[model samples]
Target: MDNSQTSILRRTVSSDTYKRLCSLWQQMAERKGQDSILLTEETLFSVNPSLAEKKYRERFCLLFSPEFRALLIGTLRTEDLLYQISIIWDTRTIADFVDRLSEESGQRTEIQCLRDRLQQILIAQPSNNPDLQCHFTLKLLDILTPETLGGLEQMYPRVSICKPVEDALRQQVTQERLLNQVITQIRQSLELPVILETAVKEVRSFLQVDRLVIYQFINESSAENERNHSSQSLGRVTYESRASDRIPSILNLTAEDDCFTYIPRYTEKYRRGLVVAIEDVEKAYSSSFCLVELLRQRDVKAKLIAPIVVEEKLWGLLIAHQCFETRQWFESEKNFLGQIGEHLAVAIYQAQLYAEVQQQKNTFEQRVIERTQELRDTLLAAQSAHQSKNEFLGNMSHELRTPLTSVIGLSGTLLHWSDRGSALSLAKQRQYIQMIQDSGKQLLELINEILDFAQLEAGKVLLNTKEFSLQNLSRQVLKNLQTEATNQQIHLELDCRVEPRHDRFYADPDRLQQILFHLLKNAIKFTPADGTVILRVWKENNYAVFQVEDTGIGISEDQLPLLFEKFQQLEKSRQRTHGGTGLGLALTKQLVELHRGTIEVESTVGKGSLFTVRLPNQSHRQLKTTPASKVEERVTFESKSIVLIERDEEVATLMCELLTAATYQVVWLIDSTTAIGQIELLCPSLAIVDRNIPDVYHISKTLKKLQTTKSIKILLLSDKITSTDWQSLSRKGIDDYLLKPIQPHLLLQRVSALVSSDQNSENDKMKL
Candidate 1:
């Protein structure tokens, strides 16, 4: 029935007139074996003889008013509970019909119930079909006494007139009960797979469809190892349902078939939570030939798909298919499946969170195990290093005291000899003086080695690269060491096999000298009397190689690796001939590595040892040879001002003397904290500031930004230059950086260059 008619009939079940008429109509319809049962005025009066008395027409009119007839007409539809209901109204009604009914004592109860029921009918005012004029059979029924209906009964009257309405109500109740049960089960299901499986089965049976399946879209996030392994999109049949006589199941069909092509379409719809329903797959997706073929193969004529959304992301799909024949999906079925997808999304989201938490737990446990092992290894290494350091310190104490004792004794003896000049020989006095000098030199060399090793360990060493003749540097090194070689009774020889093109290589000449000196001195110390030591230089590819070979007591295979270790000595005997602080070779390795080079040792015990040093033949951009004239010919700047911002009193005084000697106006600010004000006032051509000065970074930044000092050239001085410090100062417009213990000539040259560059820039701007 249409909604309006069904609502009206349902509402009338509580009406007295509707109840009385339904009883009479059912009785007559059963007797005639038909649905139509009309009650006319003549038949109604025969049933109730009191209606033929005074003002009977008026009485009928009161019970069958136009308002009542309109309500009945609006209620009765072609699909209504009642097939037909008519009321032929009598126009002769007078105003005494209600009074006549009131006067009947036996009918008063019936009339009062009718009056109350009619008053409670909540029909809309002025019905849409107000022109209807019908005689009310309800009026006669209202006037008839219950005793008269029992006395004039023809056969037994039917008592089941409201069966159609009852049946409709029952069906609605059943549908609601089933839906509630399904919803409760889904909510209570904790396992995601189980929930989805149950939902598909329930929905399939409830809809009586041929088949239903949940086609889940397994995207990268949902699939483990998808990103690391495969690039193809995938779909899996997570849940499926079927009838016993239905088409073959398409469950777990994830092969690279036609279904794979539909992933893009499914993903788009799932992202937007869109629903797709097809009455006939072939007709709706005709252009999707593969999809059509796949469905036909499965004997699926109709289909429905919905999205399962979890946390605003498309997780998967909920699909239903009708395989037996072409089936049109109803709105109600679509709504049911959509609801299932939503609940499933919640379950799946919870499952994914649980999985992620477990994964994190596993990862955290594995990291903890690895970290524990690392900490154990680090503890063992620290203990070993501590023991080695203690042993080295003990050895160092002995080494230092031995030289100091000799110097002290020899000097005291010389002092005593001079006091007793006549008692001591002239030759003996000269020998005592020579012994003192030798002991002092040995102590000084040991102290220097220790300091160099300390600096290397502390990462305080900086390279001073410059262009120099490698060939010339080697010759100078050999010449300086010739006396030492003679004293050791060893033959020292030079083998220069380097290419002419590589002879003039660029590097830190002084550091390179120290490295070569350590290697050659160690070789001479270990060589036997009359043993030969060779210093070899050659060019190979991009490297300039130097090898120091000695025919001496060579190292054992087990001790080769330990040769370059700090404070390590091969000879542990108390009567060993060779003596050293054991820091020379370690410092050599460090120096070589600082120049982006490597040092390797090759030795056979009781034969000889060969130490090879390979340094990259690279040229620095700021390379310059120390010209003999530049060192002596001092440049004078009579009026050009220079600011020296140094915190050290001695260094500042030394620089002040140097600048004044060169005829340059100098402003020495010991308190660097307020140097900027003096700097602005003097507006010097160049400012040399110590990098360690307090607030140096702030000072540099301010000086670069200040208008008064915008053109002032800045030079930074530090004990060691790190890459970070260099870049930071450079970004602040510092013109140059100079390492501490600065060479007088190099410092002056850098200052002159910076001031000259500033002048050139200003001149260029003026010309522009």
Candidate 2:
């Protein structure tokens, strides 16, 4: 052979038996044709006795059977013959071969050198290529570590270590180590499922087994001795071996139906417990049907089942099975599975606690919403009730005032008409007129109280601000009460720190006077016959103070708090004796407040009481004298078309007569209903209304609605008409308001002012 050809032959057959076979084949090929030369097992065995047993078995099968020879030759050319041969050989034969290689003095040094080279190649290769590293790693383990040999014997009893098998084993172990790290990280970082899953994958790869499952126990009923167990099964994983391209089946199992049998023992243990079963498919107990069925289908030979426990409760179980091969599980492996399961239990418990807290928060929020709605409803109801009370009071006041207006109006007419000589003697006529006047005054006072009370309730009481003399105001009040005091034989005294005429201040003069009048009148009404009333006025610290003291029946201590309440009579049975509405003091207090003043009362039982009124005083200009001509002109006679609407015929006639004497074209309507039509037809220059008419507001609204009565002046006459009522009537389009028992001169003045003002306003409108 040429040197180049010899070198090629030497490389192809470096081993002893291979070299002899190659030489024989070369000679045969040269003698005969290349086709005639055959590479046979006998030729290999003849040169190397070490290969004799393998060659004997191979040659016997190949020579006797043509099919076997063809198949062997075909497999050798296309596949790895060394690897295939190792796989087919028994584990004992391979182990013996490894042992012999270690003992032989001639090959020991060569083997050692090869082993070093293999390690260098493995270390040089990238870690990403697990198969290459695995091959070298297994080869080195076989050469250097007898412990590994023993372990492999126990782990894979029937298998032999060949190049490809060694590659797969190395890859699996490396993957298992990586997966174990991942499991540890998951346990440290996350909590349960992630750690369990990672651990299961690692174990599955290391053992070369399929069907790793995790089943969790759900306690359906938490009640003691009544706990029902349920299972949540995490399904299976499949494993593909390097020797076979086909994937083997892996199935998961859960003990949901037979939970009592499988879970009771684990619950009692309060720690990890394990079950290892071979041929679990044939087992009759119904611990886990899924596990059994899967094992049977995949031809599984062994399984390891471990419980997951947390805080003395059996949370779940992890099942790993070997499908294509039989495996013996170790104590360390079982313990690892239990630890992973424990992590899973803790995660589930935390999630449950979070859910419970969220539920309670939602419930509390719903209750708060309901309570808020209830409070809103109650507040609305209270507002509605208050509104109803105001309306009722307003209606009652209107009804009461109508009749009182007529009584006072007629009395005023009678007093005016009385002469020195009459149907009766002068003395008797004067006495009768005085009685009528007294009754009319009493009625008017009661009506005024009612009207004042109504105004306070409606929050419509307004003060008329003006500069007036406080001393003159007090004097005027005393002058008005002089006649009453004289008849009662009681001395009424006025005490002022400043001069009666010199004490000038700025305020609502009329409202202040009205409050003083009510207080004095209340003192007079409650005083006994011949009892004295004293009016005291003074100024202190920018405020004017007035005190009205009287010798009268005093208020009880218990009644003091309720003294200013509307319609509250101090002595219920004594109401008629006083001939006064209980609203006088109440109205007095409210009017004082309207003027930004305060009223206080101090009294003792069976002793006289004193009332004090303090008002903030502002400086006032000196009163200007009215011209004589202006005063006379204001009272001058004027002819006006006047309509008087009153409920009583006697009062209506008296009003008509008075207007007639004043040269007014008078139209009197006794019934208020007919007044609207009469006024509309007459189109009067002025209309006089008794506000005590039934449906008074409706009547007022109707009068306002009259189109024909444009620029027509209205004068509302009421025994109850005070400054507050006057303001309200003015807002309703009444030009002026007059109280019952009206003075002739004062009435004349208002009528003239209203008529002239109306004429001026109309002229302005025409110009516009």
Candidate 3:
């Protein structure tokens, strides 16, 4: 223990390395009940060595000094040699003793001393993989100095080999074999149960765990009808494994006591691909007695759960348990479970896709059968219509000649009487004029019927859908037919059962009026004097129903089916009582179909006939309506403003009055030149503009671009808007469009709806 022994140690090892090693050797020597021959730096620098500066230097060299660490590795030469010497001592014990000595003496100990120098070298190598490095090092050392180990044994025969290093080598080999088997199983098949069962059995056998299972959180129910009622109670014990006679099976159990209820809490823990390991369930879930009790029932003293994620959703669980006794779960086991869950999710997804494809195939076959029957029925109807068309042409030729001959003869007699200056009674001349007028009207009616039938046949009509008052439209049609109804001595009456507000619906109003007019006119023409014609309208579900009943000469059952056919009339003679071509009802039927509506007629042989029309209350382009009672009253909207820009004086005056009555402050601009200034000045919630107004699109663009007026809804009014014009108007951001001659009540309803809808949307954004 003098300077002579120090010189011997310094000659064998580096001076700095020997100093650090001496601190380590002394700790071991003390534990062995012997005195250390080496001196420590703490004892040498013992003058207030506990000062912060000296302590920092010691920690710095221990953790980060490359030069000092290099000297230690060079001195020990191999981690194997360091391990052999440590058995004559102990690395953990020496480390503990050095820390205690430093605390007691108030100085830095040799904390960085490489007592396990072989392990240190292996850790510093790339990947920190010691098995490959240890194997190669052992081979090289045996070849270079086979007798070196023999010399060490003679000095210290009690040296023990490191058990952990050997154990790690065996585990690595087992994991590699298991991983290769699993990957091959996954690649072989996509069946759900097969993939999951293989994973559970193989992973359990490799990890040497008592039990393993894949517990899934079932989001969908096996019974689809029960899904909405109670999906929370559903989960399956999908797959399971156990050691020989180690524990009872819990597979396929859907008992109420199942742990599926804990999925919500566990999902948060493992949603981000985390692994959870519970060494002891009692200790882990001490605050949650229910969770602990759930495990205890299954004799699970320890457990681990890993999440299976598919498409970024928590799909299910992969669980492992120690049934007989508490066991600690390792990082490697958790990682392997996660990999298995991922592969199983892929297999399950593929199975689901296959089931969907099979369902779609079945649905497609059923649709084909239904469509084929419809085509067959249509072909038969077409054959019957071919015969009726031939008869129509011959009857139409004679019908045309009679009207033409009357017009020519009556007009020539009047011209001859006037040119010859002959005495002719005023009453006779007047009668001749009346005959000419009636013939001309008959001729025009025939021509119009043909044109309408042709247009319907060629599919040339397009519906201009808009919200309009059905009650108001029907009244207008009846008013126009008053003269004809009076001359025919037929009484007209309206029986409206629809709510006043509900009577306003979306459809092609012009076309609807035309259908009503034709049906009413036909009723009056067939009905005798003192006969009554009644029009009834109501709403049921999403359809507006209209029925026109007349006390007329009713149709027979045999001829009723042919009533709507082209040119097929009950009286098919040239001198028929109807005195016209029989295309009216056919054209009316086609027009009803164009509006996605149906018309049907029921008649008794002599009592009366009832014609009913059902049209959808809403169109795709129509805004959804809330019930009238739910709407906020128009009187409460006195602060809102509207701008009316119409070149037509009468229409502008009418629109302004309607808007004003609805509690909107209206600014009426008759001239197109001043419309932009008026609309901007008013800053209205809505602007009603005539489509014919000069520079209307430019005005809409300007108003839309400005910050203050950008949100103002623009409703374009056009007398005849084509399909292309509608598209152009939509691009300019027109909110709603009204055809010219729109009813006053309909205009008010539309404006109120648009403004209210805009206000509601803005409120939603503010809430967000």
Top TM-score: which candidate number? 1
Model 1's TM-score against the true structure: 0.52
Ten-residue segment with the worst summed lDDT in candidate 3?
63-72
Candidates arranged by TM-score, highest first: 1, 3, 2
> After aligning candidate 1 to the native by TM-score, how far in Å is the CA of 307 from where it should be?
0.6
| Model 2 agreement with the true structure over 580-643: per-residue lDDT tens digits | 4456777888777655567899998778899999886532321123332232211111225677
Per-candidate TM-scores read: 0.52, 0.31, 0.43
Q: Candidate 3 lDDT, tens digit per residue, 449-496?
A: 798788767756666667888789888988988888888888999988
**Candidate structures ordered by lDDT, highest first:** 1, 3, 2
Candidates in order have lDDT scores of 0.67, 0.57, 0.66
The weakest ten consecutive residues by lDDT in model 1 span: 126-135
Winning model by lDDT: 1
Judged by lDDT relative to the true structure, which candidate is superior, 1 or 3?
Answer: 1
